[model samples]
Target chain A: MNSITTPSYAVHFNQIAYTELNKHLSQSKYSKIFILVDENTHNYCLPTFLAQINEDYDFEIIEIEEGEVNKNIHTCTQVWEVLSELDADRKSAMINLGGGVVTDLGGFVASCFKRGIDFINVPTTLLSMVDASVGGKTGVDLGPLKNQIGVINQPQMVLIVPEFLKTLNERQLQSGFAEMLKHGLIRDAAYWESLKAVLDFENIADFIYTSVTIKNEVVLQDPTEQNLRKILNYGHTLGHAIESYFLESPKHDLLLHGEAISIGMILEGYLSFKLTGLPESELNDIKASFLARYKKTTFTKTDIDTILTLLKFDKKNSHGNVNFVLLKNIGECAIDIKVPEDLLKEAFEFYAE
Target chain B: MNSITTPSYAVHFNQIAYTELNKHLSQSKYSKIFILVDENTHNYCLPTFLAQINEDYDFEIIEIEEGEVNKNIHTCTQVWEVLSELDADRKSAMINLGGGVVTDLGGFVASCFKRGIDFINVPTTLLSMVDASVGGKTGVDLGPLKNQIGVINQPQMVLIVPEFLKTLNERQLQSGFAEMLKHGLIRDAAYWESLKAVLDFENIADFIYTSVTIKNEVVLQDPTEQNLRKILNYGHTLGHAIESYFLESPKHDLLLHGEAISIGMILEGYLSFKLTGLPESELNDIKASFLARYKKTTFTKTDIDTILTLLKFDKKNSHGNVNFVLLKNIGECAIDIKVPEDLLKEAFEFYAE
Candidate 1:
């Protein structure tokens, strides 16, 4: 497949990814190469990743625990100290070879280690490849808050080897599919329609490539998420709050990022219908598409209130207002709209239905 | 005094500093204003800083404990949680009002909080004003390693108020003077000659301004320290190792940053004479000037060996080689020169003299 160009770096796919990666490794005078992986990727993905690197430089694998709970500064500190202990210098390059947690935390680790070092993202999960792969956003969660501490530092390159998706289970694959579904909802209705069909995990390369293209286009226009980029947060406002709530609550089962956001897209879709002139027919389509793939999640009134409280901490919020990107249509979004509290509760009811 | 313009921001001095700052505050629609200080600054500098901000905004003070020992990632985590808990959003602006610890740590905090927010540096200490003010080098140290974790992100502006210098003692003033002397040693003999005279702490504004200009010029030429910027690290290689050694060791009196680097300049001066052809007469001149201001200290063979081990962790090291910036003459220098382990021990002996 063809490589997608971002302002600072490129995303190369499949067989071409290895070529580009090896070329970059051989050309840059990296003192040492440190591959960052989590427990899952270290066992399942590292072997396949190791075979592709043609460089003769010294390679070291730095592994951390998997999951969002482990994605915090404390983990970053451990990785940083490890990098320091192993004598990783500014000239040393890091390859983040796992899901979002590893890539996000590792990118932050490299960016702040000795005031920034070069890193490449070899995203191992479907969710990471589609969403985290493009944007220069690299950060870890702060307590219950997600991506609260990070910088908008770009990587040297991103290698998306779809074959790595073989390591993911059905639920994990569906988690990444949610973002691909979002790309169609926010910017491309036709793409959204195509994504509703039952997807073969073996043939997901094209969909992943297209999803990245949509995200990259939005990110390129507003790299810092100033105005135009707010559209990308269509489902994320409530999605993130829900994600944080599930992540922290001992009583609830942990929701995968995509799973929570899938619920978010439905809730926000209802908000769009009421507030942003999103047609009721389009809202029904969005709701149906997500619910088919994701199991319907019911939030208690108390759970709804707690999740609403978390919205104030959203990064996109400005001047004490929780801003939402509601859709005017399936392929179009209205940025920075505030919905009333009662309406937010109503949207939760719509999702519960 | 005229405002000095950096590529991205300006260094406004004295009355103009307040005017520029107030103007920035009034003009930008920051959601809230956060002033970060240490315990010392919160008590000593905050009231003075608060009186100067003529804008009406909801102000929040986030104070950390004072000292170089507290400049670490753990401290940063605490500050990050505080910002989050306080509802510091992307639109919120932070004013770092204190010495290098506050400015460096606060800048890192602001830079990473919600993927960076606008921050201004109000450096209080002489060392911070001369060294940390203009470089955009913001970070916290990692376990015994000085500035091992940081990013080269500039603040919105730097407000250099000479009046704040009155808060420092003689040792602190001498500590800042070391960097000013370094400016002259690496780039300007004329400036070096001018700085050799006994300076009045009360009348050091012009000297501070010139020092910033000298440092800014080097940074602008090579912002990322790719080549020409390496010249700025002339005394820092050995200086940082010495600083880290003194910082971590309980047996030694805590050496101020400038105090340790001043010793570094003298030690590197000897190495320069041996390896880089720094004239013996000039080397003696460098030695006499620093010795008159700083107390001479003796290091045992074992202490020297421990410091040598710390050199491997210096940010400037690349490809397992410890690089030093050595002076070829009073105003000229060589960069990336490797000193033999034996020569390093000899330089410590030279300092002992």
Candidate 2:
């Protein structure tokens, strides 16, 4: 049983699992409850969620198509209209019960519905539980761009349940592991070492808890992303560009956010070795760990050029400069480091290897 | 030269005028500049604005179609794509240079672009200068619903130039006057009487300044609209429903926001007289002032039923209750006041007179 509070909201672990959720709901006395889920979560997670909560409060289930492509303004409009049609008032609470797609879109829809409404995240995927659901960054993509339209609005609460992770496939689980690895790389060496030592799902709950705590701590310190919060975006700059690139390319398979970021970490690690003087041994360790888990992705000369161009659109960029967060050491990262084009090409070469 | 700062941003009247805007722009040193204008403003107001700002900065003009219909997600997508195609970075600054449609959509686009960016509102309409530009509420309409999907993010600055009002037609001018009169009715009896006494466009600048000040004061007190801010929505609850109803109905002409709210104020005045014991004479005075300026609108029995049904969708509602902000007196309002259906019908009858 553990609880952590950010400036805007709170995250509760096993202590306030199901019974606590019912109690919180009863005490809050919301007018009605609406649960937002994509097809996958509606099929897999909703039944388990229903079984846990004993309260007979009035609630409705809203299902959207699952996947990254569905995370757009059209979907948002549909959800908003549905909420309005259902007569969801300001006092009504929404529970987002799915992965990143559901939580991100639902959080945004809730935030803008009638200016805003109370929403809680009950993440049903490893990727979302460890990463997306913890932070207040909720939004959908604009065209092929990633999170181009959104606001930094926190949810009322985030409930993390490990039982929901039973539904994730191996790739989905690995996708989430990338962020956990990121938490260790950016802040804690021992945590990184511990995560690397155990790649199995035996203590997945412990891993999620630690990841959540690390992300929550960083976000709490810098909710507005003035300085410290940018550190949380260590792999995100290049990672996001790559994610958007592949998501838009008709020929390439869509890369899960974590998968793209994993490649970004490897490329950034190489850049770190070249520019930031990160030890070659640590860089090798990083490369080996990522390559072993994530399938190697190849980019052509044209693809590289496109990715470079896309980097300018990264929200982190200011004054058209593509800033990178490179690892100074395995556990320490430096921000706003500008890397040379030649070194970026070499980093891509290293990732391809 | 008067400047008032809200918790979110600042409103500069005459002091931080065009010259100050030029200096502010130079000091900020943004990556790029963009001006969002509707066709009307582009044709009429852009020349005046360009002439005042002597400094030449790298800027582009992005124009959308004029009127309320264009304030939708599709328009937002087009503007976002244009910004993307033009490579507008996080440091880019957007100047919303039109009436409420341009400012509302542009503010929302800028807020969500790259998570958020710096934007300044240069309101070109009386309604916008006094009301829309002051509050941080920015969004496009969802279907016939007004401001259904939006956020409460303020601009970096609001620059109000009354010179833009010279281009407005009499109906448009009167539309804005409705809100000014509302400012007086809800908060300042003296202000209300002053507005009633002078219905002509002469001394319109003083009226605009006073209305902006009053609205800013109320918004500053409650940015989140939890308590004090709800008072500002006094006429909006029913007014919004009526506006949305007419906008959707093929039989009726689109009512200007101020026009719809004027009728709402009269209806609410009747409710206030019945439920809150607002003086019969004051209610009569309120009705007379509104009818003198705005042409009386007639609502059939079906229209009233439809408008009443639409009340449930008002953003102000909670727990299915059509909560309203009713006038307790000419100078004060009580929020979250629920009026019975019978009383609502009577209020409509009072408006018909």
Candidate 3:
């Protein structure tokens, strides 16, 4: 498959393409290489990574504790201290060798270290391969607010090798699938319908690649989220709020990003039907398809009110108004749509139905 | 004077220019405004700033504890939390209202806030107005390391109002003067000679403005420090090491940035004479002028060894080689020159003499 390009970087998708990574490394001639990983990937993925790279390169491994909770400045400080202690310099290149938490934190760390060093994302999870790959958005969550602190900086390259997906649990796989579904719902109705047929994990690389291309095309036209790129946030605004809400409430289980976003897409589908005239039948189809895959998540009345309040804190919002990305039709979206409170309530009711 | 433009953002220099700031505030139409300050600026600069603005603005003040030691991830978290709690949105503009520490941390915070928001710098110190005004460098020190964690991000505008300098102590004024002297040595010989004639604070705005222009021109040519931009680091290489050294060592008082760099320029001048064949007379002249202004700093043999070791940690370095930017002569310098250990020792001896 051909490589996808963002304004500042490229995304290369190959199945087990260690040679491609090696070739790029030789050409760049980095002073040293450092791989950032979480405990899980360090244990499961490092052996394969070491075996595949057929070059004598000076490299070291920096590991952080696993999971999204560890994705904060505390971990960043630890990693930075390690890099300093190990004497990493401006010419050093960091290979982010894990899932979204690893890549996101590593990308941010590298971008700020010496005003940025070269970083290549070797995404180990499906969510990162498609979602995090194209968007040059690198950041960490602040106090349960997802991605509140970060910079829009592109990595040197993104190397996607599908074999790493073999280790992901079922929940992780499904979480990644939600983003692929988002790509389809926002840009390609045909892609969305085809994705509905995907029940198993067999032959998912092509789908992931397609989702990345869709996102890349959108980002190329609007890198700064001024207009077209906002379409990519169709499910994200509400989804992110819901994700944060659950993460903060001890009573609720933490919603994997994809799971919360799955709910968000359904609610926004209903909003699209009411506000943007997205066909009612298509809205039902969208909800039904998502509900079929992601187990239904129930939000209490108070939870609904809290989520609504959280919407004001959404980065997309301005002047205390929540601006949403709503679909005009499947595969077509509108940016900066102001949904009324009654309509938002109705949309949630529709999701419950 | 007219605004100076870099590839990204503008620097506006005016004396008590509330009208210009009001005009910019109205034109920007930010959802709200927030001013970031330290205790000193809040006490001294804020009232003057409030009295000057002609237009009404819906703004609030957020104050952090003063000093370079406070520039850390902890402060960033606090500010981010405050911004979140206060409901500062993506469209809100942040005014960094103080010296280098405030501008540096505020710039980084704003840049990372929601992937970035617009920020305007109101530099209250001479060090910031001339030096920090141009370069998009924003960061805080990591564990006594200067600017160890930061991103190269420009503010929406840099508003340089010279009246703020009135409140600065003599030491603060001298510290800032060191950078101005550097501006002359690295690029403009005539400017250097003109600055030497300056013994009073009256009519220093032109000198500050000239230094800003020289730095801006260099930055416009090379924002990434790929080659030409490294010229700006002429004194910064050894200077940073020395700054970090004193900041960490219990035996020595902390050296202000400009004081450390003053020493660095003399040492590098001596190295230039040895390695780059800079004229002996010119080197002596450089040393004499710096010594006349900055109090002499003495380093023991152990201090020299430690500073040399710290050089490897300099962000400008690559592959364990300490690259020095040496002067070919006044107003001219060379980048990436590797000085041998013996010469580095000799340069220190020359400084000690």
Candidate 4:
């Protein structure tokens, strides 16, 4: 594919990404380069990424422990202190070479270190490539809440090398596939229909490219999430709460982000049928498509109640009201739709069915 | 005298500030209004500020401890939690009603909360009114390093009510005055001469206005502190190191920001005379002026050595070189000037004189 242009930066793919990154590095006189990574990326992805650098440059690998649990302010504090200890000055550049947790936290670290510094995002996960690659939303989870403490800071460039997808487990691939499915659901019916079939892991690059293009177009219009950008949070309203609930609960098996959100899309699809005139047939299609791949987990009444309460803390909430983005149709989304609690319970029941 | 318009927001003065604030409050449909204060502002300033709120609105008072000690990410976390607990959504507006500590930290909190939110700076301290009001440099110090973590986020407006000056003690007032003096030294020599006379606290409002104007003009050109803005740090390089050293050292008496920077101006002035064509006569004049107001603190050889080491950590530093903004003349400034360690030692000796 070709390079994707954002409002401020570019998203380069495969060989082009390496070329652009090298060109950029040569032109910008960074005093030093700090590559942020997680333990997983350090072992699996870092060697390949480091090999792509064409020049003999000063590089520091600052690795954090992997996973969503590590993505918090404490981690940020440690990284910042490390940067300071390592003499990472204002002129130094940082390259975030991991998944969403690494990119988001690393971008925030770079943006905030000495007011702001230049950083590049080398997303190593399918999830990060499809979702985090386009948006300037860089932040860390606040306690159990997801992405609560963060800022909208764009990277200098984003490099999406699809070969890294091979590093991800089947669960991780499926998790990323959720966001790609979200792109189709929110804006492209034809794409949504195409995604209903089995995800072709062999041809994943094309899917990643399309997903990024969809996200890029939306964010380019509303980078700040003022209005149009809220559409991107289609399933995220309930999805995040579900993710947070499962993340916090010791009893439940950790659901991959995609698995939880897959359930969110089904519940939200049901809400759309009742509230926004989404056809019952389309909603069923949405449910069947996700259910075919993701295992259906039973939510106890307490779980349902807790998740509903958690909705109030959603970043999308305003005026003490939990807002949802429901599909008017598969290709179209209606933002800021205040879904009633009783109807939400009904949507959950629909998910169970 | 008149509203100083920034690139994005306006700085409303005294009575006009209240009017603009009230007008703004009435116009924007904020979910809630959060007033961030410290213990001092809560006791001294909030009563008067609350009275100015002509209309009854949902208000939450989020107080952090007063002083620079409390300005850190830990305090930010507390405030962020409180904002979340208080349901401070994206539509909610925050009014930062304290000194530089409150305004800088609160602006950072409001900006990073839920990505970003609208905030107003109600600068109660002269330091905040003149320096923190216009720059859009919102941050908290990391360990002893000042402003190590933050972003350049502008407020919706800045309200400078000089009456708030009455709430500050002599030390607080003096601390703010140092920054005002900085404005004159960096940009307006005549203003510097005028400020050398004993500060008439009754007429302090005029000084604040002029200082803000000088700062506003500079920030309007380069809000990001890329190049020209470094001149604002004319005295801050050594000043910050001196402040940090005192702040962290248990043996030393706590120096007000102004007191430390006052010394910094004298030392840097000597360096300027030696390295940047600043007249020795003017350098002596700068030292004499500060000595007349501020008591000379003894910095032992160890203290001097530690402060010099801290210079490497300054935000202005890039490419492993500690950069300084020196005075070319009384009103003129030179940026990115490199000073050697031997000359720096000599400059400290000049201060001892």
Candidate 5:
């Protein structure tokens, strides 16, 4: 409640995680409260969340239909119209209890409502709790593009209760794990080795903490993603294009955030091997590990070609060059590495192995 | 062309007026450039704007269709799509050139694109150059309602070239003049009277400086509009509802911003007489003078009833209470004055004179 306490938000994570809903929420300083749940969260997560929170305080429920496709300006307007209808005033606070789709878009909706209102994030999916919830970057994505439009606004607090991750499917977990792996690879060799053993969800708490810690520390310094933070985007360059490309095809399964990112890491890793002197055998070791864990989704040469086209248009590509975050060995990354067009196909081929 | 050393931007009557714009903008030092313009501005204002700028910089022009009806999340999406297409990067700067509609919506789009690229605002319309442009408030209006979604982001610099006023019709100029009057009523007394004679389109440099001076001082003290600065909403409390109601009707031409505020001033002035014992003669004089300059649009009892009903849903009003900004005196205003529904009706009747 004391927002000025300078985001000692870490101290409250456990309190947020384990405390009985009634004991803490009844004492919450918010005058009026609401929960923002996307369609998926409304169906899958809100019922449980509703059960836990005490009914002592006045509360409202706002639900938006879920999915990455809905993360557009039109959806944001619908959410705003609902907020306006509900008489959401400055004193009102929203608890966004959903995945990255809801958390990111809902945070942006709340941020723009009357020049902003305080909101708390309870990221439901592993993708959101560990990744999207930490950075305070919130907005719906532009059409077919990932995070094309948004604002940077930190929430009052992010309530990370991993109990919600139990609802995430196996594909979702694998997808989320990719970013956890990415966080470690970009900055911490020791953290990477420790996480390399996190094969199942049983030991997720440690992985989440480490991943969020890496993200939080980077955000604390750069906040704006000017220099050091760009390293956090290690695998997302081609990963996003691949994700968007797949989303366009009706036959393709919806890839979770981590799944797309996992492929991104492997592709970027291959580029790293070719451009930087990352040993070919070590690259194989990295590819084998992900390939063994994630069932390979074969992309036709044409699918990859479409993705490559999008990569050229990526926001990361400064000055019209396809800039990449390439790995130096396994633990390091160098920003702004330009990779040629044909080599992209070679990297994907290398990643397939 | 040194931006920082650009000569003072102000309207001088018998006083000096100054505000810093380049000071904050120079810190950004962008690489590429972008300008957002509405259809009206693309034709009327952009030529003059391009002429004034340094010819060396390459720029991209993004134009949106005009009208308050297009101001929404959809419009923002189109603008984002354009920015993304142009390969706008972190170093890209956007110039929002047009009216309140353009400044507010353009500012929001720039703030969200790539999680906020730096943007400067060049307000061509009077309402924006003085009111919407200065507050760092940016977002689109919702449907027939007023500003329903928005963010607070100061532009790198707000370029106020009164030359754009030449393109404004009398109705548009009257719309913008309301804020100038509100600025005077809330902050300075002598400046308000001088404006009755000094409002010459030919000699507007001094007037622009005067308006910007009061706004800049208030914004400098409270960049976020937390306290004393809100007094600038004196007439706007009911004026906006009146404006929204009229805008939704077929008779929008009859009711402009200054005209609506003139009515709001009369009604609130009557409320002020009841609430703060403001001399009745001063209230009469105020109403007469504003009416002398601003042609009045007659609202039937039913129209007043509809506006009052709409007022119940205003973002500024809470708990089903109308929060009227009442004048304590000629140059003083107070916020959060809860008036009885009956007294509000009575206040309207008092203005029937």
Candidate 6:
């Protein structure tokens, strides 16, 4: 167990069990309700998933063309016009039954419609249920930038039954699992050690539950991501750069979020070992554990250099310093730690081969 | 005193001295605050106003071309982009010091930028301080339609400093004063009588305070205009139709809000007389009092006919039967009362000569 007790929610993550869903969907008068889904969830996740929902509602499913590239103000305005034509009154609610992009976009639409209405989150992705749902942040990307325009408003509640994870390919599942692992590594060493035995889909449920608990506690401490919440950005600092770098490249689908973060953690662990004098054993253990689980993708010196350049544009660099969250130990984190140019170059070489 | 209680806020008018404004201005943290004015206020009202507000704020004045014709999505967006580039942050507060249109549009634009920021209302026109600011119903009209898209958020607090009425032209002051009289005719008889003596700017400060108090109480009872609040829509049933019709005409300056509503009250009061056998004396008192105070405009048969045609679009007309708020006496109101088409035409002709 970790000694760090920070304020956060006690988020529960499980399969979207039928009996579990039926319990909460009692009908009320609605002007008109809508379910927003993205292309992926529309095909892969929504059909059997909606069958599990208990009651009937006067609602239609609104689907947008898939992918993060479509998450912009134009898409949001289209959704708003549709809702307006549908005669969505104050009594209406939107069920965002997809991943983070769907919920984030849906929540933004609902917040600005006739000056805001209600929305419920049904996060289908592992990254979404544990992280996005617990935070009240909702927004859309501006042009090519990330989350440039948004608002902070909490959902009525988030339904985190995680059975939707079944449809995800192995790569997708592993991508999500990386965030779960980082939660344990940054907050609870015992939980980190406990995870060594079970890192695959077969045991993703219990691990998801524990990871959510750790994240909820972090959020409860600082919901705004002001101070301690920066710790959650540990692997994400570099992980996002790597994800952004690979997203524009020819190697896009070879990895998902968890896969990218797993790589980020490996390189960051190497950085930890080199600069912080983290015990060599712990460093190797973290690397070998992720290597054993996540499928490795090869990147050249140029890819790392491109990623390093992109890191400077990160949204969190408010004061223009590239800050990293480095692990002092398995259960400890120190933020705003900058690494040297040569050290970063050397860490990327650890995976170059 | 009229036997009817003033319904919580029906005390007669009273002035708030310049010292009161100085005291209230000291409480806000703003280093430099601004008073937004239009061509009308700039020419007719600013000299006395600037003299009074001296030393309270490092005030900056901005003027826009006035009139309801200027209220459009383009203006709102322009105002937003300007406010954003001006470096107005969370700490800065805008004092919307104007009539209904300025308060409505200014409050709406300020509410949406940077997601939202704080603002206060110092309503110069009676229509705003009494109804718009008190209920926090801030939004601009979309195109020719009224508040077709908007939000409901409260101002920091509405300062009911009515001395600003002193500079309003006789017609402009009466344009606002008509709504105050409607408040009494619909909700408080004592208030209606109180206005008979104090409708002029000489006694308007006290009356403005009472009008604000009455409106503030009614709004608090039902802030969203969901149920109990709809009672406040007494004269507004046909009033808005007459207002909208006049708005589209080249002769808009010939008809202000009070003139349209005075005509509406007379017409709607005639409907009450028809339905409830409200004494002819009360009906005549309604016509005589509005005529006694207002320079009643002569509406031709075609003008009256067009206004009646437009009444069908009033938001309160749920099934399009033209629901009316009728006065049983000076203070008593009956909601959801429907009037016959022929009777409405007859009421319009009641003052045709």
* TM-scores for every predicted model: 0.99, 0.97, 0.97, 0.99, 0.92, 0.69
Question: What is the interface RMSD, in angstroms, for predicted model 2?
Answer: 1.3
| Candidate 6 residue-wise lDDT at A270 | 79
Candidate 6 chain A: worst 10 consecutive residues by lDDT? A1-10
Q: Relative to the unseen true structure, what is the C-alpha lDDT of residue B54 in candidate 3, on a scale of 0 to 100?
A: 75
Interface RMSDs of the predictions, in order, are 0.6, 1.3, 0.9, 0.7, 2.0, 5.5
lDDT values of the candidates? 0.91, 0.87, 0.89, 0.91, 0.75, 0.69
Please provide, for model 4 over A86-171, each residue's C-alpha lDDT reduced to its tens digit, 9 standing for 90 to 100.
88898899999999999999999998999899999999988999999988999998888898888998899999999999898888
Per-prediction DockQ:
0.91, 0.77, 0.84, 0.89, 0.59, 0.13
Question: What's the true lDDT of residue B209 in model 5?
Answer: 66
**lDDT per residue, candidate 5, A180-212, as tens digits?**
888877888787777777768965875787677
Model 2: residue B237 alpha-carbon error in angstroms? 2.0
Residue range B142-257, candidate 1, lDDT tens digits = 99999999998899999999888888888888998999999999999999999998467789999999999999999999888878889888778888999899888889999998
Q: Between 3 and 4, whose TM-score is larger?
A: 4
lDDT of 4 at A330: 89
lDDT value, residue A40 of candidate 4 = 92
Q: Runs in model 3 with CA error above 4 Å?
A: B15-17
**Candidate 2 collision pairs:** none
Choose the strongest candidate by DockQ. 1
Model 4 segments more than 4 A misplaced: none
Report model 4's chain A TM-score. 0.99
What global local distance difference test value does model 6 have?
0.69
TM-score, predicted candidate 1 vs. hidden true structure: 0.99
- Flag the better candidate by DockQ, 4 or 6: 4
lDDT of 4 by residue, B110-169 (tens): 888988999999999888888889988899999988899999999999999999888878
lDDT of 1: 0.91
Question: Which digits, one per residue and each the tens of the lDDT, describe model 3 over residues A1-353?
Answer: 87777778778777435667888888988898999988889999988888888788998999999888888888998989999888899999999999999999999999999778899999999999989998889999888788888898988889888889998998999999999999988899999989999988769988988998899899988888899999989899889999989988999998998999999999999889888999989998999999988999888899999998888888888889999999998899988999889888887888887
What DockQ does candidate 5 have relative to the true complex?
Answer: 0.59
Please give the TM-score that candidate 3 achieves against the real structure: 0.97
